[model samples]
Structures are given as C-alpha cells and as structure tokens.
Target chain A: MTELFDQVRERVRRNVPVVIATVVGLDGSPPPSFARLGATLVVAGDGPSAGSLGDDALDRVVEADARRALLSGSSGLRRYAVHGAGDGRPAAAAEPESGGLTEASGPTLAVFIHAIEPPPRMIVLGAADVSAALVRVAKVLGFRVTVCDARPAFATRTRFPDADDVVVDWPHRHLAAIADELEPCDAVCVLTHDAKFDVPALVAALATRAGYVGALGSRRTHADRVARLRAEGVAETDIARVMAPIGIDLGGRTPAETALSICAEIVANFSGTPVASLRDGSGPIHRPTRA
Target chain B: MQDILDDIDRWRDEGERVALVRVVAVEGSGPAGPGAAMAVSEHGEVSGSLTGGCVEGAVVAAALEVLASGLPRLCTFGYSDEDAFAVGLTCGGVISVFVEPVG
Candidate 1:
C-alpha cells in the first residue's frame, strides 16, 4: 500500500536507513507459492514491517534479510525458499543470504531488497566563496551538504542558500560532534585557507572515517600546512590522506571551477579511480572541435 | 523510489492507485543499475524510469496489468532476436522488474 511507501519515505526523510523487500519473482513449480510477484514488505531498522510477501512466515524471513541489506547499504536481489511449514519462515531454511541464484528445493520467492540510506554527507568547513560553490555542486551530486564556519557573519543562510545546514560553530568542534556519524562515503572539504581555521579542522577531519579529506591552498601553502600538521604530531599516513592543494589540476582559477576540481578529486578518490592528470595521458582528448 | 516520490505524492493526492515497478536485477550493460524504479498510476500515467527510454512501455503495460488484476508480476525485458516488434531493451542487457500495486 501507499502507506508502506509513505513509511519508507518518512524514514528516509529522517535520515533513518530502511529496506524495501519486494517479491520480484515467484516459482510455482511445487504449486501454491506463498508469495505473488510484486508483493512487498517494507522493513525499517527496529520498526514494524509494513505490507507482506503474502505469508507471515515469508515476511519474517524477508524482514531479516532486509535488515541485513540496510546494514550493508546496498540494493540487490535476494531469495528464500518457500515451504508450508510453521508460522514463521526459517532463515536457515534457505541460504539466508543467497543472491537469489540458489536452486533450492521446491518453490522459491525472489525478493529484490532495495536499501534506502540517507544521502552521503559533505561537510564544508568554511563558509566562504569556494565553500558556497562547493555546497552547490555537492548538493547536485546528492550529498547532504553542511557549511560550517565560526564567524556568524560569513556562515549565513543567505550566503550558502544551497547548503542543508549552516553552522556558526568552530569548524573543528562541529566536525568532532558529527565525527561518529561520518563514514567512508562522507567527505570533509576544508575550504578555509587560513592556518588558524584549517589546521585544526584538518586534524579533526583526518581522525574521522570521512573518505575524502581535502584542504584548499596552493603548493607552497600545502607544504607549510603539512609541516604544521607534522609539528602537531599527526601521523604520516593520516597526513598523507589530506588532499592539500585540493582538486585535480584542471588549471581553472574561478571559485566554481576550483569547486569542480575539488569535487572531482573527491569523486575520483571515493570511486577508487586514479586521480591521474589528463596531461599525463596520451591520445586525443577532444572531438576534433566539431570538425 | 525517492526520485519518483513527488509524482507518487501527487497521484496519491488525486486518489490514484499506483503500481511501483522496480528493477530487481540487471544482467549486463544496463544503463540504470538495480533499484532503478518507475511509478505508474492505474490510468497508465508514469513517473521516473528504469532503462534508457527503452523498456518503459513494457513496464507500464505490466503495471497496468498488476493494477487490473490486483496481483503483482515479474516482467523481464531484453533483446530477443526472434521477436521483432517485441518490447525490450535495445541494449542487449536483460533486466528483471517487479511490478506491484502500492497504496
């Protein structure tokens, strides 16, 4: 029912992880399948399940699998062997974690478990020109963007209208408060080119599981920042994770262009793609200027 | 589903029964990955997409069927050399879609 989908949308709006297990396939080889193709079970983390796979027993089995999919934060297909047994479906009765490819005995219920996770976070640690630009791009890329700066004057909602959150707290403290929530999918961009703001921000950003940690500055500034980080006793590996002189070498000078370069680096880094410069690659880079 | 929420909400506001069609599996070279979904109203109005403008017609047909029969169905769309005029993906990739009636 739409109420089930509403529950899913509500949970997603609250940034709570949920899973939708829909019966995508049903094999009636053994006759009388408990699930119909298109039957659905909406499973929320630690919440009551909405809808059903046409059987209480099968719903329990799918609920468990949905919880696991929520934990893994991936959407894919899963399968459970249907049996006219007890009031509940047995997890061990099937592969339990099969990828819907198992040729189990009797009929089978193939459910596509889709995980609805909160959008990945992008915490911009500065509310300057570049920070505002970065928030715009990050939002377009489906990140929950937060722009944090200590100065209330700079970090106004009017300044970064696209940012989801505008915080006037010290950058490092703001990062520390939300550090536990940050995962490898999140990113922290230190657009504060100042040593006072950026140095401590980098220290906190590196400690978190945030996948992309970058500081904006020129080469000379990056070298100085690195030496300062070393002096602060930060580990070499942690220091190395900092993408100072942030962004790929697109050679663009505008704030928007810089933001693109930085976000490009973030995307490339998180996707595990080599951040190789285009100049390093040999071959035609363009489509011959439209002939 | 999130991508098509606005339309789903509008259709729901207008008292329309919607069939939710989701891509459960993609064999190879699918333009959209698994979880790609489309919401279809009982009247065949559609929102969102599953493939690169290829299999939507078939999915809408299936969604309408699910709404009419009140039973969900699994529809597979892929390139079939023998069936010319068949509704399938132009790209050789196969996708398994689940079409269900949603309140």
Candidate 2:
C-alpha cells in the first residue's frame, strides 16, 4: 500500500494524471485475504497499475471504474454487490448511494475512486507588464502559466521566469495552434494593450472551450473591440463570453493588483461564484484613496 | 496526501511507522470533501489536514492508536454523529475518515 501511495505521489508531483482506487468498505460473511480492507491500486495515465484489490475480478472492475473517474475528474464512493448474480461484473452504472454508511443488500464492497489531474493551463497573451504579474499570480494559484507574445524581446523566459512556458508568436495563431488542447479548466488572458493583438487572440479563445477568456482594456477600447468583433461575424453569444475590461472590482492599482483581480475572476468563473467585477460596475475602477 | 508526500518520505527513510488517514465521505456542507488526506508518523509528527483544523488533534490521536494496534479502522467526526464531542468538526457536517497503517 505504501508503494502504491508513493507512485501516486510521484505522478502528482510530475503533474501526471492518476487514479487511486481503494477498497474502503466490505460487507459479507468474509472477504478474500488478499482483498484485505484498504487495499489500494494506483493507475497511471500510460503505464502499469500498482497494487491490487485482492481478487482479480474485483481488481478488474475497480480498474475500469478508476479510468472512467480519471476522465471525468471526479471523486466519489461506489458500492457493488458482492454476491449478485453477476458478481465482479462491470458495474452497469454508478448510482449515487445515500447515507455514507448505508449498506446495500447482499454483500457489498465500497471503493473510493480519486482522480488527480494535471494542473490546468493559463495562457496569458502579450507578455507585457501586466502579463508578467499575471503569470506570477497564476503560478502561485497552481496554474501551468504560459506567457505568449508576438515580440521576441518581450516574450523571453527572463521576462517571466515563473511562467511554465514562454512562447513568442502571433497571439491568434498561437491560440489557434493549441486550441484543441485547451480544456474547460484552462484560461486565456489577453493582456496586450493593442487591438491588433487582442482582437484575433480573443476571437480564437472564444472559439475554444477555455473556461475563462478575459481581455485587459478600458471600457471605450472594449466597445471598439466589440464593434470589430460584430463586424467580423462573431456570434453575439460567443462575443458575450469574452470578459472585457476584466478583473473584479477590487479597487486595486498596480500591475500586481490587476493580476490578482484577473486570476480571482478566473477562479470565480470556474467555481460558478458571482463576484462584483469592474466590468459590471459603473464606479471608478480604483478608489481615490488608493491613488 | 500529495501535499504531505515529502514529510512522509522523510519519516519512512527514518523507518518510522505511519498511519494514513483519508476522508472517504463528507456529509452536508463539509469543509473538505472525499480524498482529503493526512498522515501521522509514529513520532507524533502530522502532515496535511482533513478539516479546517477542528479535529486534526483527535485524528492524530487516532492515527497513533492505529499505528500501535496495527489495525485499520473508520472514524467519523461531525455534528450529527452520536460520538460527536469535543473533537467534532465545528462546520456542522459529517466526515468519515479511513485510517490505516501504510505497509
């Protein structure tokens, strides 16, 4: 069990996807000796599985469930009948069992399936002053941050040493090339002050499933960009997904404060939490006291 | 569990027995959900946490007991539980933790 746990730790450290399936409960006359309670199995993304849950049939069933859980990015307890007609067969479906301690009819075994996914990516465009701070803040928040810019001089690794990746390329082209890799957990932030860069970059971002698509700009600049987006035939709903004049109404100044707001907004977006953002409020973005 | 790996490895290098505690199920408004884990070394060192620091001391005691008895058991801490006492979580939710010695 310790060896299995060590494998799980290694995979998590390397940001590799893994699933840990542990036999948490057993109810019956008696369980197999090898099927001792708390027997755990660690399954990696593309390698051999470590440990087992005693019986081969039980291990097979749990392994399949672990893979599904890993893909869905969820953890939960699942119960199976120990002596059903088709005992040890693939579970047809995992119904939400009520009461953590409620035992099902016949002998039952409960396995807790926990999936560990790689940290999501935060692709920040422009590599400008704000981008540098945003990259740092996002890294602190456990995101695999990538700083991208069209200018070679500004996008170097030295400028954003904390970022996981520094790519010097046109914003839209870079986003499009890696669009398929973006998951709903990922984010895209357009920090370029220039419309030429922010527009196409946002267009590409909105086309993907990236959960948070934010652009840094003033209200007038966002209005102009909206007109350009409408002219380019981007749908109204898709355009609405863009968080223009991004960041929460933290009334903060400086690049670090703005970066905090943006990262906080991304977290709020994913968590389905409503926050008071500057984009939604009419008052001054920063308080006079701070200035 | 991932957060406490370094400390666990250090303890293991020194050949100390350790108990791993995992939150298997959380009931209603619990602070931490399933898969939240913590480890307690034989030397009484603890790493990670199951809740917002309400029941960790009791959990460490449970871990030491498990290490001494060499037994795996399930312990629950919450407001609605019959055993709710000084060590229950203040969050008004129930969390069932499985404590077992690492082999």
Candidate 3:
C-alpha cells in the first residue's frame, strides 16, 4: 500500500497523466460501502492498474472506462450494475434489461470515480528572465511548465531548474514534437519578441488545441508581427486568437510583476473573466485563486 | 492534494498520524477550488490549507474528529450558518470539506 501510494504521488508530482478511481458511493443489496468497496485504482499511460475494487470484472470494466475518460480529460460519476446479466461488459455494451432496451432492471451501483489528470502543460518559448519568473509562478499554480529556446546557453537546466523540461530547440520544432500531447488545459506563451523566433512559434502553437496562446511584446511589436504573420498566410481569425502584448495591462515593468500579469491573463482566459487591471476593478484585493 | 503530498509524506515517515481535509466543493465566492487539501497531524501540526485562513481552525477541529472516529466525514462552513459551532468565511462563501484519516 505504501509503495502504491508513493508511486502515485511521484507520478502526480512529476505531472504525469494519471487517473485515480475510487468507489465513492454504492447502493444495492449488500452494497459496497466504505469498508467493503473502498479501493483506489491508479491508472497511467499504457500501464497496468494498481489496486482493485474487490471484483476483477468490475476492475476490468472500470479500468477500460478510465482510459477513455483520461484521454478525454473528463471527470464525473459512473454507474454500474452487479449480477442480473452481462455484468462485466461496458455500459454501452450491456443491453438494457428493461422493456424497449432503454433501461436496466438489475441492481445498479454508483461509483463516483474522480479521474484527476495531471496539471496542464505550459510551454514557454524563449528562455528570458521573464520566462524564469513565469515558470515559477505557473508551477506554483499547478502547471507543468516547459521552457524552450533555440539557444542552448539560455535554455539550460541551471537556468530553469524548476521547469519540468527545458528543451534547447527551435520553438516551432519543439512544439511540433509535443503537439499531439497538448490538451485543452495546456497553454503556450511566446516571450521571444524577435520575429525570427516568435512568428514560427506562434504559428505552430496556433495549430494546437491549447486553450491559451499568448505572446509578449509591445503594441508596436505586435502590430509588426501581425503584418508579418499575415504575409506568411496565417488567417486573421487564427492570428486574432493570440493574446498579443501578453498579460493584463497592469503597467508592470519588472519581470516578476510582468509574470503576474501573464499568469493573471491565463486565469482570466480560463474563467472567462474580463481582462482589466486590478486597479480599475472595485472588487476585493484578492480573488479566490483557481488551478 | 498534490501540493501537500510532501508534508503528508514527511509526517507519515516520522510516524505521525495524519488526518486529511479536502475541499470538495464551494459555493459563491469561496477562496479555494475542489481538491484543495490540508493535513493535520496528531500533535496539531498542520500542512497545507483549505481556505485563505478563513476556515483552517474549524477544519482542524473537524480533522481531529475524523482522526478520533476513524471515519471520513463531509463538513461545511459558510457565512450564513446560525449554528453555535459555525465558522464562516469572511468572503461570504461556502465550502464543503471531506475529512479522512491518511494512513
């Protein structure tokens, strides 16, 4: 048990995608209660599950469903039935035991499996001082941060020791290598103002399904970059998705404050909050932080 | 849960019995999201926080009961409660916590 928990903890700490399925609620004759049905299944990529829910059939069904849920990045409660007929089959496969095949008459049990995927990935393009500050802030907010740059000297482990991965490669190429793994919770931040780096990086990042794609630059720099990207055949709609001059307009000049601004923008992007300076807002000093 | 794992692991290594309190849901303007966790050891040592100091003391009391009873429970603290033991959030939010023993 200790070893299992340690492995799950390590995977979670490393930001590896994992699903922990626990039987939270059950109801039926001899329903699996806390003591009888209490079990945790730790499932990861193409790996065997650890722990069981006292029934091999149920574990197999749940593990299969869990993999699908993990891929979809969806979490919710699931229902299953015991005994009656075709017990271990997937919910879709099990024919309804009621009339018209629309319902089941068997003893159904509810399993509230809370599938928690690892923190979303935040890919930072450009190994600048602002990148370092942003990486720290993002990590504190439960993001799996990766720092990428074309320059090896700038993108070293020593510079971004806290970063989950530091890739010394061209931003677009690095993004290409990881595009398939990027999810809706992921984000891309292009901090390199140089068009040589920012243009291709933003172009590639826009191709992914990352929820947030931001670029750091002045308004003038953003306008110039937009013209260049338009010349490169990027559609206006695609270009508009980029949060240029990234971060809220906090008039922040320091790297740390700038980092906060960018982080705040990311949160606002997720929560659908309007991006405005805290100074202009009349609410409390600090709002409840979310991951 | 991920943020407080190190503290919980260290306390467990030191042979301390720990109770874990996790914020499972929130209503209105709560300070934390679901899965926010805090662990309290047998000696009252605490790691992590469920809210922004708004309800930690109340959570600790609930955690002590969880440890003593060896049973998990769902606890709620909010601004509108009239109960004598009510510990409300200054932000006028309601948070539901799950208290369990971490073995």
Candidate 4:
C-alpha cells in the first residue's frame, strides 16, 4: 500500500498524465461496498493498471474507459451493470446469470468509475514581467505552466522559478519540436510583442489542436502580424483562431492587471464563460470571497 | 494531491501512515475544483488542502478516521443545512470529499 501511494505521489508531483479510477457506486449481486470498492487504479497512456475492481472483467472494462478519460482529461460518473445486460440493470431484470452461458446470457455489474486527471498545461511564450505575473496567477489556478523564450538569459530559472519547464529557444521552434506531445487541454500564449517572435509563434501554435492560443500585441501590431502570418501561407480561417490583443477588455495598463486580464480570458475560453471584466460586471469577486 | 506528494512520501518512508482526502465534486462557487487534495499523517502532520482553511480541520478528522478504519468515504460540507452549528463550508458552496488510506 505504501509503495502504491509513493508511486502515485511521484506521478502526481511530476505532473505526468494519469487517472485514478475509483469505484464510487455499485449495484446488484454483491455491491462492492465502500470499503471494498475503494480500489485505486493508476492509469497512464496505454499502460497496465496497478489496482483492480475485484473482478478481471470489470477491471478490463473500467480500465478501457479510464484510458479514454485520461486522453480527454475528463472526469465523470459512469455506471456498468453487474449480472445484467451491461445496460446498468440488475441481472434478473435483464437476463439470468448463467455460468458458461452465451453472450446474451452473461451477467453484468454497475460500477461507477471516476477518472481523476492532472491539470492542463499552459505554455507562456515570453519571460517578460507580464509572463512572470501570469505564471504566478496561473499556478495558483492549478495550471502546469511552461515558460519559453528565445533569449536564454530571459528564460532562466530565476525568471520563472514556479514554471514546470523553462525552455530557452525560439518559441516557434520549441513548439514545433514538442507539438506532438501537446494535448487538447494544453494552451499556448505568445506574449512576445515583437513581430519576429510573435508572428512565427502564432503560426506554429495555430497548427496545434491546443484549446487556446493567444498573442499579445496592440491593434496595429495585431494587424501587421495577421498579414505576416497570411503571407507565411497560414489560411485566414486558421488565423481567425488566434486571440490577438490577447485578453479581456479591461483597459488594463499595469503588468499585474494585464496578466489577470489574460488569465481571465484563458479561463473564459476554457469554461465557455462570457468575457467580461470585474469593473464591467456587478458580481462579487471570487464568489463573495468565501470564508 | 500533487502538491503534497513529497511530504506524503517522506512521512510514509519513515513508517508513518497517511490518509488522503480529495475534493471529488463541488456545487455552487467553490474555491477549489474537483481533484484538490490534502493528506494527513498518523502523527497529525498535514499537507496540501481541500478547502480555503474553512474545512481542513474537519477534513483532517475525517482522514484520520479513514486511516484507522481503512474504509474510504465521501463527505459533504456546505452552508445549506439547518443544523448551522455543524462544521461546514462557510462559503455557501457544497464540496464533496473522498477520504482514503494512502498508506
């Protein structure tokens, strides 16, 4: 038990993609009681699981679902019927549980598997003051952050000590190298206002299936960057996906305020929430600052 | 859960038992989302957190019970109850916690 806990702790600390399958509920035959049902299945990409659901067949089914949930980074309740028709009903209600019977006569069980995946990655493409602020805020909000920049001096450990990874390379080049590793839950932010860096980064980021891609710039810079990306053979439709002048319209001028705006935009993008600043809205900050 | 791994590992290595509690679900406005976790060692050392200090004490007690019984459980706390004297989230949000023996 200690070994298993240690392994899980290591994986979680490293931010490796993993899922914990817990049998929350069960029905029929002998319902896996809460004491017996609390088995931890450590799931990684197409790998063997550590724990079981007390039955091999049940483990196989839940493991398959856990893999899918891990890939999608989704968590929800799922029910599988025991000694039933696999429709989440009791065995007698569907078909009689018969040993060595045909497929139609097989019994099923209802097990609720909840997949707990790690937080998403947020890759910030500059180590500027705004990036520093954004990194702190993003960390607080449970994002695994990676800081990237072409200037090694700027993208140092000191600049982004809280970041999961700090890469000193051209933003586009670094992204291209690791594009295959990025998942849909990941995001890319091009905070380098310089067209030389921002334009190429935006072009490369748009190619990925990353959930959000935002570029930092003024209106004039955004227009120019769009033209440059188009010239580089990026389609207009693809270009439309980039959130230029990246952030909610908070009229934020300070670095910290701007970082909040950008983070707010990212949250809105992920949650499908309407983009509105606190000043523009009437709601309390942080659910009335819960005690 | 992720943040307190080092502490959990060190404590477990020293032959200390640990219990883990995770926020599996939440309703209304929650300070932390599902998957937020906290761990308590048999000796009463604690790390990580499931709530904004509003429910950690309750969570620690619940975790100690889970460790002793070796039975995982789901615990809920919020402000919607008429029994206002009971320990609950002062934030008015409902949080479901899962407590299990980690070691």
Candidate 5:
C-alpha cells in the first residue's frame, strides 16, 4: 500500500494518469479471505498495478474501468456482481457502470474509483517579471506552468526557474500548439502589456477552452485592446470572458502581489465563486476571511 | 494528497510507518469531495485532512488500527451510524473512508 501511494504521488506529480480503486463494500460472500474491504489497487499509466483487492478477476475489471474513467476524468462508485466460489465464474464479467450507492439485490462488489489526472496547465504569455512571479505562485497552486515568449532573451529557464517549461516562440503560436489539450481548468495569462504580443496572444487564448483568460493592462489599454480583438473578429461573448484590467481590485502594485491577485481570480473562476473586491466598501479593510 | 507528499516523504525518511486514509465516496453535502486524503504516521502525527472536522477523530483511530494490524479497512461515517452518532458529519453527509497502511 505504501509503494502504491508513493507511485500514485510520483505519477500525479509527473502528470501521469492514475486511478485508485478500493473495495469499500461487498455483497454476497466470496471465499473467507477473497475480497477484503479497503483493499486498494492502483492502476497507473506508467506500469503494472501496485496492490490488489484480494481478487484477480475483480482487479482486472477495476483496472480496465479505471483506465477508461481516467480518459474522460470521471470518479465515483462502481458496482460489480461478486460471484462466489460456488458459482465458479469470474466476478464482474458483465458489470454495468452503476453509479449510485443504493442497495443491490444480488451479491455485489462496490469499488470506489478515484481518478487523479494531470494538474491544470497555466500558459504565461511573454515571460516578464510579473510572469516570473505568476509562475512561482501558480506552481504553488499545482499548475503546470509554461512560460512562453517570442524573444529568446526574455524566455529562459533561469528567469522562470519554477515554470515547468520555457519556450522561445511567438506566444500565440505556442498557445495554438498546445490549445487542443487545454481544458476549462487551465489558464492563460497575457502579461506582455504590449499590443503586438498581448493582442494576438489574447485572441488565440480566447479561441481555446481555457477557463481563465486574463490580460494585464490599464482600463484605457483594455478598451483599445477590445477594439483590436473585435477587429480580429472575436465573438462578443468570448470577448466578455476575457478578464481585462486583470485580477481583482486588490490595489496591489508589486509583481508578486499582482500575481497573487491573478491566481486568486483563477481560483475563484474555477470554483465558480464571486470575487469580493470593491473600492467603495466602508467597513473593515479586510474581506471576510476564508476558512 | 499532492500537497502533503513532502510530510509523508519526511515520515518515511525517518523510518516511521505510515497509513493513508482516503475519502472514496461522499453522499450529500460533505465538506470534501472524493479523493481527499490524509496521512497518519506510526507516531500519531497527521498530514492533510479528509473532512471538515466531521470524522477526523474516528478516521485517525481507523488509520492507527491499519498501522498496527498491517491490514486495510473501510469505514463509513454518517448520522446513520447510530453507534458513532457523536462523530457523525455535521453536514449530514455520508462518507466512506478507506484506511490502509502505506507499503
């Protein structure tokens, strides 16, 4: 079990898909020691499984189902009929994707499958000082940070030491190359604050399914950028999705503080929470604390 | 689980046996979702959390049991568990926890 957990953590850190299937409930009696509750089997993308649920046939079925679940990133309970030794047949031979925990009439095996996939990626456009800070903060949040810039001098491993990858290419082009893999959990931050870089990058990023698309600019710059993006034929709905004049109104000026504001927005965006940043609040200076 | 890897690694490095507890299922308004995990060391140290203080005490007891017995066990905690009504989830959700010794 320890080895299984170590492998699970290592694989999750490396962005390798893995699933943990635990026998949480059992129906009907298998052999005296065949299937024990809480017996865990770890099926990972890298290699053979590390533990077992005390049954070979059940393990195989769970592994197959777990791999399938990892592809679409679903996690929940799975039910299989546990055919006893007297039946002399493999359990889970004709299992359905039963989701609920409701009782079953016949013998059943309930395995709770937990799928752990890659951490969401954050593509930071134009590796600036602020981008470096964002990379560090985003890494702490478990995002696979990628720093991209057209200028080779600006994008270097030394500058963005914490980023998972640093690429010297046009920001939009790099984003386009990796766009298909981007999901709603991912984020794209445009920190170039220059039209040439930020405009095209924002356009390409909005085209992707990344959940949070933020651009660093003043109110005046954002208005101009919106007009440019409209000229590029981006949809109004999508344009509205861009977090221009990016981040909450934290009144923070440092690069690290700005990055914190940006990442906080990302967290709120992912969790579907509202950002409570208003300049007109009269009461306490601090917002209500989060537990 | 990802956040507490450093602590678990440190416990292992110090030759301490450890047990991992994972919340495999949650029915209703549980504070945590599935896959939430906690690490318990042989020395009774803990890392991470499995619930919002709903059943942590009972879970630690189960984790310590796994550490001592060298065997895994599944535990269910909720208001329906009459015997453990005191430690039931305040949110009225049922959670299934899998406790296993780390290999």
Candidate 6:
C-alpha cells in the first residue's frame, strides 16, 4: 500500500498526470457483490496503474474512465453499475459487448476519480519586486513558476526562492524557446512595465496556448503599449488577449497586494468566473483612499 | 497528503496507528473539492484538512473510531440530515469521506 502511495507521490513530484479512483459507495443489495467501499486504484496517463477495484471488468472500466478524466483535467465522482454498465440493468450474456457499454443493470459502484493534474505553469516575465511577490503567491496556489528576466541581478535564485526556475535571459527569447511546452493550463504575466520588455514578451506569449496572459501597467501605459503591439504586426485579436492594467479591482497598494489581485485574476480566468478588472471597470486602477 | 509526508513517516516509525480520511465527493459549495485528505494518529494528531474548520472535529472523532474498529468506513457530512447538524459543513454542502486505517 505504501509503495503504491510512493509511486503516486513520485508522479505528483514529476508533474505527471494521474488519476486515483477510490470506490466511495457500493450497492450490493442482492448478494454476488460488485465493488466494496474504500477500494482504490491508481491509473497514470502513460499506461501504468497500481492497486485494483476487486473485479477485472470493473477495474478495466474505471481505468478507461480515469484516462478520460486525466485528459479532461478535472476530478469528480463517477457512478458505474456492476459489469461496467451505465444503465441500472444486468448485462446480456450472449451479446457481443464493447466493454464500456451501458447494458440496460445491477449494483452501482461509485468511484471518486480524482484527476491529479500537474501543477499549472506560471511564467513570470520580469524578476522585479512584483514578480517576487507573484512567484510566492503562485507557489502557494501550486503553480510551477518560472521567473525570466534579461538582467542577471534581478533574476537571482536568492531573490525568488519560491520560484521553480529563475532564467536570466530575455523574456521573449525564453518564451519562444519553450512555446511548444505551454498549454491551456499555463499562464504568462508580463510585469516588466517597460515597452521594450513588455511588447516582445507579450507578443511571444500571445503566440503560445497559455490560458492567461496579463500585463501590469496603468491605463496610459497600456494604451501606448497596445499601439506598439499593433505596430509590431500583432493582430487585434491577440492584443485583446492581453489583460492590461492587470489584476482585479481590489485597490491594492503594495506589491504583495497587487500580486494577490493578479493571482486572483489568473484563477478567475482558469475557473471561468466573472471578476471586475481594471480593464473592464471604469475607475482609477488604485482607489483614492486606502480602502 | 503530500504536505504531511514527514509527519506520517515519523508517526509510523513510532508505531502509532494512523487513519487517513479523504473527501471523495462534494455536492455543492464545498470548502475543498475531491481528493482533499487528512491523516489522524492514534493520539488524535491531525496532518491535513478536509474543510475550513466546519467538520474537522467530527472527522477527527470518526478517524479515532476507525482506528479503534480497524475497519474502513464511509461517512457523509452535510446540513440536509437533521441528525448530522453537529458535524455538518457550514458552507451548505454535502461531503462524503472515506476513513481507512493505514500502515
């Protein structure tokens, strides 16, 4: 049991996607039995598994569903009937079955398929004070963070200890090099606050499939930056993707508070929630008073 | 569960029996979603959390009971049940948890 758990921990540490299916509820009213409560099975994306849910047919069914759950990148409880059927009726004996069919019933097995997705990637483009704060907050949210900056002094290991990677290189160059690795679960935050770094960094970031791309600056700065992005041949659609004047309207004053707001926005984006941002709301980015 | 690896290891080394309680399903407005887990030692020491302090006390009592019985049990916490008021989540959600004794 501990060995199986150790394997799960190893995969989690390596950021590999895996699914753990635990049978939480079982209905065996008529005797022969289907699945017992507390039975667990772990399935990985790369065709590896540990433990079992008693029956081979049930394990096979759960493993297939687990793979789908891993691909969907979400976790929830899934109920399946005995003999791998979806309908609450017994399967026919003579019929050629597809193994994952719902053969119109028996006892139901409720397996909670927990999709263990890799930590979402957060690429912080600029190793400034705000970047350090963002890196810390992102780490708390279980993000695999990478801090990039051209200046070697700013992108130091000691400065951003919580960051998973500190690359002392131009942000755009690093982003272009690793563009293929970026996915919908990844985020890119351009915090340079300078046209030189922000434009190129955002251009390259927008090219990737990163789910969230935000830039930190005031309204006037973002307006000027938008023109520069357009001048550099970036499409209007791509420009719209950038969350300028980044973060929620929390009226955050300090760097840490601003970082929290930005992190909250990123979460809101991933979770598909509506949040009042400086980009959408009409007002000063910071409140007149401390409130 | 990963956060409390060291504590679990130390407890196991000391020959303390442990029960792991994991939140398997949440119906609505749960503080934590599926896969949230906690490990409780024989002496009532806890490692992780399954809720925002609404049901931890009841979960601890359930963990102690599982350790005593040496059997796995599935417990549900929510406000819908009249008898479960003392252990239900204040966030108005139903959470099903599985408690199992671990080596």
Quantify all predictions' global Cα lDDT against the true fold: 0.80, 0.82, 0.75, 0.73, 0.82, 0.82
lDDT of 2 by residue, B1-103 (tens): 5567778889988999889998989887777888888999998999888897988988998899999998777787788666678777787787888898884
The sequence of per-residue lDDT tens digits that candidate 3 reaches over residues A1-291 is: 234566667777776767766554444544433223335577887477888765676778788877876687655556666653234443331321211111334454444344556778899999999999999999988898999999999999999989989998999999999999898788999998799899999989988989999998767787889998898899999898888778887756778888999999899888888878432344343345555
- Report the lDDT tens digits of candidate 2 across residue range A1-291: 666777887888887889988877876555433446778888887797889776666777778888888788788888755442235453232343434567666566777888878889999999788898998899877798888898998999999999888999998999999999899999999988788888898889998999889988888889899998898889999898988789998878899999999988999989999998767877556679832
Q: Write the per-residue lDDT of candidate 4 for residues A220-248, one digit (tens) a residue.
A: 67779989998999999888788767778
**Candidate order (TM-score):** 1, 6, 2, 5, 4, 3
Displacement of residue A74 (Cα, Å) in model 3 is 4.8
> Candidate 4, what DockQ?
0.31
- Please give the range of 10 consecutive residues that has the lowest summed lDDT in model 5 chain A: A277-286
Worst 10 residues of 4 chain A by lDDT: A96-105
Give per-model TM-scores: 0.86, 0.84, 0.76, 0.78, 0.81, 0.85
Classified by CAPRI criteria, candidate 6 counts as acceptable
Query: What does candidate 1's lDDT look like per residue over A1-291, in tens digits?
Result: 555777887887788898988776656464334555667788887678889878766777778878888899889987676666443444233555466443655667777889978889999998888888899989887799999999999999999988889999999999999999999999999988899888999999998999989888766777798899999999999998888677777757778987888889888988799875332333432224332
What is the DockQ ranking, best to worst? 1, 5, 2, 6, 4, 3
Model 6 C-alpha lDDT per residue in residues B1-103, reported as the tens digit of each score:
5555667778989999888888877878988887788889999999988998888999999999989988778888889767577987888888888888776
Off by over 4 Å in 4: A23-37, A78-112, A276-291, B13-15, B24-34, B43-45, B51-55, B76-84, B88-96
List, residue by residue over B1-103, the lDDT tens digit for candidate 3: 6777888888899998888776655778977775566889877889888788988988898888877887766677886567524688888887767676766
Can you list the residue pairs that collide in candidate 5? A1-B103, A2-B102, A2-B103
TM-score of chain B of each: 0.91, 0.93, 0.91, 0.91, 0.95, 0.95
Candidate 2: residue pairs that collide: none
lDDT of 5 by residue, A1-291 (tens): 566677788887777889988777776644324767677888887788879877787788888998887787777888877665455554443464586666775667788888887889999998888999999999988899899998988899989888889999999998889989899989999998999888899989998999989998777787799999999999999898888777776767789988998898889889998885321223433346465
Interface RMSD for candidate 3 relative to the native interface: 5.6
Instruction: Say which prediction, candidate 3 or candidate 6, comes out ahead on DockQ.
Output: 6
- Local accuracy of candidate 4 as per-residue lDDT tens digits, B16-93: 989877776677877888667788998888999777788788788888888888887777777765544476677778
- What DockQ number belongs to candidate 2? 0.58
Clashes found in each candidate (C-alpha, N, C closer than 3 A): 3, 0, 0, 11, 3, 3
TM-score of chain B of 5: 0.95
